[model samples]
Target chain A: MQGDPEVAVLRLGHRPGRDERITTHVGLTARALGADRVILAGDGANRAETVADITERFGGPFAVDTVESWRSILREWEGEIVHLTMYGLEVQNVEAEIREAHRERREPLLVVVGAEKIPFDVYEAADWNVGVTNQPHSEIASLAVFLDRLFEGRELDREFEDAEKVVVPQAVGKRVVEADDE
Target chain B: MQGDPEVAVLRLGHRPGRDERITTHVGLTARALGADRVILAGDGANRAETVADITERFGGPFAVDTVESWRSILREWEGEIVHLTMYGLEVQNVEAEIREAHRERREPLLVVVGAEKIPFDVYEAADWNVGVTNQPHSEIASLAVFLDRLFEGRELDREFEDAEKVVVPQAVGKRVVEADDE
Candidate 1:
């Protein structure tokens, strides 16, 4: 992710109590899937903390923050905007152009992932409105697949620095060793 | 998906009220991303109904069902079993083999998605314990990416039949039309 353009995921319209876990998953997925950071655009301070805790333990070049105004983030964003929605053009159709802009052209990417309903203006503001599949499902999943495609699966092999613990991938049981980097 | 192995997702150890939406998203992701069905291995009747309702509206050959004992379902399962976990073998390393057994050998696939902590036996029972990434993330995201990889990205091109409504892919606007197939 170092050489890749800065990728930030903006989680819009989080309903505090109802979306607590879902929003938390959104942040974690973004971090694990190669996004440099995530901006929570609602009252998701606690969710931000959960992700921050994971980052603290698991390691991070990842950042998580809470923002009061999502619209301004959109208006002031300096790079390419991609809105992930069920109604958008298929990701497979638009991934190449996007990857070119972000990876080849080195344009920063702001990916907008929404909750239940999104405002139309967000769609209009995006350079590409992309869908992992034009069907009903989880936004966390949408972001995961979209990022995977954007990185062309290289993110899976990524090793995090400054970690306190690292998973030792096993065939049959759990195994996590303390980070020797410390 | 028609000719592929019968893929079913088994969600284990669901804590009713707290895991409601996360479980629902699991079921929906399973359906939308090419799984033939999702077997909710807990008290997920309401969650099953929610998925069923979406299936009814969106069209499906997809099925959602609740089981009293998850162990029984796993014990009686007819084909290969895959448990998704962060501590498991990296998916990129094992996906081809898993795909071969399911796609070429025509063995059914039962993908186990866990809630909080999965029992050690689940790992032992699985033919392959796979991780989408050796990093912490959402199970819904793991399932979506795993299925996408297993299907080699063809699932996004899938068309659901008997749908009452279908999304017309857009670049910057929302559009849904009644399925004329009805």
Candidate 2:
């Protein structure tokens, strides 16, 4: 919430034992799709570390952290809140409005993605509850689609500044290019 | 390739031991994003059955099959070929043109998604080698982004007619609506 007006992600409802891989994917999707940072708000302390490790390995101008209470965080955010849910207005219907507001207000945009049964308070607190698709699917897919639209597809070209291992594009074979120090 | 002029997917380079989950996701992404059918090309005979089972359970107007030879299939394809790859032209740049061409020709689209190291011949055979992003990412993510863009996000609203279990959109809690017969 303290960063520049660039978009960030708030992932709530992570259940540690049940959501390890899914939670890590949420963070990965957020970073890969142009979020400047992610706040994992829930009881998944180990999940937060796993996500942080991914960021560290993949390289970052991105940050990751964990918080205990999403209710207080959502209530206190200074910027517009866009909660991703299946029941909300379609993303295409409201993305332009959200983008316009973000530009005019010049405040950080917090895009919320939930992992478990999100409490009713979140829907009430969000400025916009948007759905990438109404159908049931992976939250990772929803975040990917939402961020792609929010950034207008420009994020596809974004490059990580410090990746230790990078894929080298090939016409015939597989090769991962790693840092010389490795 | 024998289907209507609507979209179809060809998933190539399936490595059975390594690409089980990735290949399954490719099928899921294809079905979810509005492709009418997907042909699992190359090795991994069992992968075809896994994908077929998913479609059977999730409900589909979608079709799934497997083939041993992608080279022959690509050569004989009756429609335009659009291969998904990281080294190719960006999807946003070429998607409009591809869509326009498909419309004008009334040709079925064969969208190729690879699971392992794709051979060079694929690049040459494809009518358009489209990149969802230049970065190395999951094939599932790439397929999702590509199909969403191809259909101009309309696919987001599509509903499966026979899904045994469907997610009910909720603002506050999770509920999966199940078919009474099941």
Candidate 3:
């Protein structure tokens, strides 16, 4: 999402077909806002069929990789990470996966959306923890844009210098783009 | 476990120190009865650790290979094949990764666990389907063997066959092990 400024919307969810209603809704909204990728994770109802359906709708260049736990993800971490950890699409081994991700140490634009408030560990890991992606969808949708705003904003790291960087180590080597409300 | 002359006792749930227990118990029970391998699964704490500690009891004679999922088990499928499709493990991507396994229609030894008991379906593609693993410590130990015996010799399949099999196809492949009372 950082590579371009035009992406207006993004919706993360579990599976594709079963979650197609939400994906379609997100796709329409993203097109309205001019967003980038419609990211997905977790096993939705009718997973194989659903993913196949969603893959057809993404009309641009993107990478789809099969990851075994988030540990491998951190080892392969690059710049500006984003986690759909608890994006309303529950899956097996999530707590274990997130624990692995925390061990990996990557700092990107983290925006997680779930039904209820996320557990404490995720919020500490996320740059912006926006609870309930579906209920008050419109309001949280605006929060995604706020991330774009901060990315475009100057001296984004000024907040980091103010607070102790206890979250992650400098060895991770990535600049964090955080928002005001976050 | 009751009908058959041999038995395989599985110590479910997590505890890094299970090997000592497995060694002591397996020798005390299964060894005395002259049973086969006392199969042990879980990350010691319900897939919590990198490997099940029980795999390393003896040095040369008892080397254990702990596979994260059944897909990791490379078996030449011949005879009455058993394909256990539990509703809660992390192996949900099997339709794609091991698509070939499902391609050729053949009977197999399928051991389906979890699903019916778990509160959700998003994680059903997993091998263990052990959502209860996350419950309180007292809640985690498996209840299958005793439940089988309690029911009196009729395996779960005779009763739950068409019901569960309809939701997950893998159940259709096995001659589900029965209990004793039936």
Considering just chain B, what TM-score does every model have? 0.97, 0.89, 0.25
* Candidate 2 clashes between residue pairs 3 or more apart in a chain or in different chains: none
RMSD of each: 1.2, 5.1, 22.4
Q: Report the C-alpha lDDT of model 3 over B1-182, residue by residue, as the tens digit.
A: 22332222333332344233222332222211222223344443232121223222111112122334333222321322212221112122222222233224322212222212222321232222221111111111112211222222232222111121111211111121222212
What is the docking quality class of candidate 1? high
Interface RMSD per candidate: 0.7, 4.2, 23.0
| lDDT (Cα, tens digit) per residue for candidate 1, span A64-180 | 988988999999999999999999999999999999999888999999999888988999999999988889999999999999999989999888988899999999898888998
Native-vs-model 3 lDDT?
Answer: 0.26
Clashes of each: 0, 0, 34
Off by over 4 Å in 2: A1-4, A12-25, A40-60, A66-76, A115-125, A157-182, B1-4, B12-25, B40-60, B66-76, B119-121, B157-182
* DockQ ranking, high to low: 1, 2, 3
A77-139 per-residue lDDT for model 2 (tens digits): 888898888677777788898877876668678889886578888888888888776654456
lDDT of 2 at B111: 91
Name model 1 segments beyond 4 Å from true. Answer: none
On DockQ, the leading prediction is 1
Q: Evaluate residue A56 in candidate 3 and report its C-alpha lDDT on the 0 to 100 scale.
A: 38
lDDT of 1 by residue, B24-116 (tens): 999999999999999998676568988999999998989988898888888889999999999899999999999999988999999999987
